[model samples]
Target: MASITPWRQLLLDSIQANKHLRHSEYFQLATVKENGRPANRTVVFRGFIQGTEKLQFTTDARSQKIEEIKTQAFGEICWYFTDSREQFRIGGFLNVIGNAETNPLRLKIREQAWFQSSLDSRLQFAGPSPGIPCVKNGPDDNTTPKLDPAEGPVENFCLVTLEPQEVDYLNLRKMKRYSFVKTGDFSWTQRELIP
Candidate 1:
């Protein structure tokens, strides 16, 4: 058996150790527009496509971010690991995860989880609904509403894919960093970086 390189070891460790990173906390995604300007937002990571090395996240179909990606297929993702004092910046092409017929199951699951986690009895009817005025109500009036996983807001869901072409890792311990560009399948061209 062959030994794992330090870079690969670090990446594996970071991914496995933190379950939060597996969700939508550390992903800072940036997408460009046809005018060459950039739009960025913090997105939640839904899952990874193991075979193609693609990262997945959820978004709204009518969101400005998705519209921007439609104009530009390239994007960048920044992942910061506070525990390891490391930051990973991945730049790659953007891909939409579904077709006209097929729905994004992964994104749906994540959305359901997010909805369930954020449910307050007082805020059950607080979503976007016609004729529902947008005004702050008293806490007593904001009772948590029951969420039906099958009947929640599913029409607005979508998934964004990030195919990393370049990944740069910065380590705060040694004040060292390494940059990796996709060279071949499961392989990369690595370069050392200045502190």
Candidate 2:
């Protein structure tokens, strides 16, 4: 039997590891600010695109991150599974799937994603827009006036995709780490690192 290359193995591991951790799918996303600083925030890891290193997530169009992304598309995602002591740092560029007029496919994807969202999730957007002050005695508070998921693909809905150029995986359990960088079409370069 032949062994798979290091890069392929890393891809396989990432795809699998992310699948079973649905309930705990939060990762820290780091982006560069215009003032030459870094911004880090917690974002849910939606899913991965098969045959590619594209990661998916949803964000509000009014979110400050959207402006940051528009200004600088490059960002990084850090996933640390606390229980397993496994971590992955993914570096990539952002792809904002905006309104239907801009990207029809992204709109459809947003629709589908919305279709799958829970009432609780939909209610989040129904409240205050991202990064806005709470509406005094209004719907600004979370968990009020639940909205149907079917009603969305709201004006604020936006799909954000991460096109990963490199992935660094560290398995502290075994005390090993490596990085895989995409070099070309279906090609990657893997380098072991001292952890």
RMSD value for candidate 2: 3.9
Segments in model 1 whose C-alpha atoms lie over 4 Å from true places:
1-9, 18-24, 98-126, 129-147, 150-153
lDDT of 1 by residue, 36-57 (tens): 8887778766556544467777
Residue 106 C-alpha lDDT in model 1: 53
Q: Tens digit of lDDT per residue, candidate 2, span 17-73?
A: 656766447889998877868899999877654445577888888788888897799
Global lDDT for candidate 2? 0.75
Q: Estimate each model's TM-score.
A: 0.68, 0.82
What's the C-alpha lDDT at position 10 in model 2? 61
Q: How big is the positional error of residue 88 in model 2, measured in Å on the Cα after superposition?
A: 0.4
Which regions in candidate 2 have their CA more than 4 angstroms from the true location? Answer: 1-23, 135-146
lDDT of 2 at 34: 78
